[model samples]
Target: MFKIIDLNTLGLGQEFPENIYFVLRGWMDSNNIIIKGDPNVIIDTSYCKSEKETESIFSFCGMKPDDLDMIVNTHNHADHTGGNNKLQLLSGAKIAMHEYDAHYVNLWDESGLNLDFSDWELPKFSVDNILTDGDILSFPPFDFKVIHSPGHSGGNIVLYDSKYEPLLSGETILNGDFGSVHCFREGNRALFDLRDSIKRLAQLPIRLILPAHGGPITNPQKCIDDCLRRINILIKEPIKMGYHFIRRWFIHAVLIRGEMEREKLFSHVSEIENFYAINKRYIKINNKDLFNEIVDDFIERGVLVDRDNRLSVINP
Candidate 1:
């Protein structure tokens, strides 16, 4: 387990040339990376709520708003790009993302299904540069090679710096498994492409995986191998995979409120068209009955409990 350290105690405002600092806090456990070099670089700006915190972090690293040279976004997700406009305005740094994802970054309303973006407002911004696969970004002592890893999102990319031994992976490759493939959009939840992307990443010489969420993964190979093994099993037993997927998100939504009405839970999960899309593609099921079945399945498996028409996670 990664130790959760208080950012204030780290004295991040101190200067350390040629070092990477992680600002991991706020909503979604958002991680904003600061790379100290000749042309200082920041990766993923986290959510809107983290704007002030991110600014403080930059100051802690002895960097002012205008000190940023470039802001690289891993994808178009709101949480990752929410602070883009603010940071750009404050630092006047050039914003860069994949061409496919650039549109969403500038729009502020393009996200996957079932995600509650009501609390945040994405400000429109222009892309200063467009990044593509195999692109090499030079930051003095470190050179990061961009790898386009789609599945979680159409334009997701992972940055690899072998010499530094850190893979700046967004949400594409999590520590133990691939990020969510069941998105709101139809083609966005492409499981096959996600599997291929994971396989491609496994071949890389990655020592550390700095993900957008959770803790940084030190045992890169083991995480990749475990993810692959899990995917293989999921491929063979898609229904079980689907069950776990639904259950995972279902519990997450409910846990947010401690408990929720059964109808409300079903309504929320059913909103993601990709959920049924994936199910229909794999299970060959038709109709809304499967949604109920999945909910009942979760209850039966003891992953959840239902009482008085309300659903909640089974507390351990």
Candidate 2:
């Protein structure tokens, strides 16, 4: 059984990047990046269940939602793009996203945006400017070169600040792992694409990589190398890839909710098998069964512990 690792344990706190007002998020939220500048750009506002919460998040960073001038999305994921509409409406900020990924956001297509997996609804947000690779965003504080790193999702990007921090790799490369792929969305193409993206980013002279989750990566090259290794493993062992997806989902779910009734979690998991585990020719697995099997394995390996028919991470 592959050991299930908790994101919190992988190191979430203790990171303070100078170029950003990093809002480390909990509850399946992407780590939000706020660049307080003349233009005041906010990348990946994360999943705020309410506007008040969103406003509070900005307030904590000593700003209001209306202070933002631009909303730059790293990808089309709900966690990354969820707060675009609310923030834009409040601040009148023009939203910018990769032209390739903007199509789904512009259309507000939940399925295409992969919002179908989210329990919370993301309000429709439109893009005002379409970004391409090599686009330079010059704000008063700093300039960021948009690097289109499409692998985790179509149009996923890494904002590279050459003069300062290297990259804001949104869901592209976390500490010891990368983002999960939805076979239902891109089939096996996602894995192949992810491998290529990691290869390209690995060549950069990077010392810091601020990911959308977990924390900032100090040894970026090693992390990038690890990401490539994981991608290769997934491509070679497809069923193990399915295990990876379900394992992360359950860990995140339990992390957010503390614990859940085993049967209830399994039933809910069964409801969304096709979202991450179905691609007739490429990926085919009943996530419900896989999820159950993963749980037993986790318990056996002490990654998780079962109590009163409820499941939770051992020390999370």
Using Cα atoms with residue i matched to residue i, what is each candidate's TM-score against the true structure? 0.73, 0.83
Model 2 regions more than 4 Å off: 1-19, 117-120, 252-260, 274-276, 279-288, 297-307, 311-316
* Total backbone clashes of candidate 2, pairs 3 or more residues apart or in separate chains: 0
Q: Over all chains combined, what TM-score does candidate 1 have?
A: 0.73
Task: Give candidate 1 misplaced runs (Cα > 4 Å).
Answer: 1-18, 26-29, 106-121, 183-189, 241-316
For model 2 the local lDDT of residue 180 reads 84
- Candidate 1 C-alpha lDDT tens digits along 80-106: 776888988977889889877876655
Candidate with the greatest TM-score versus the true structure? 2
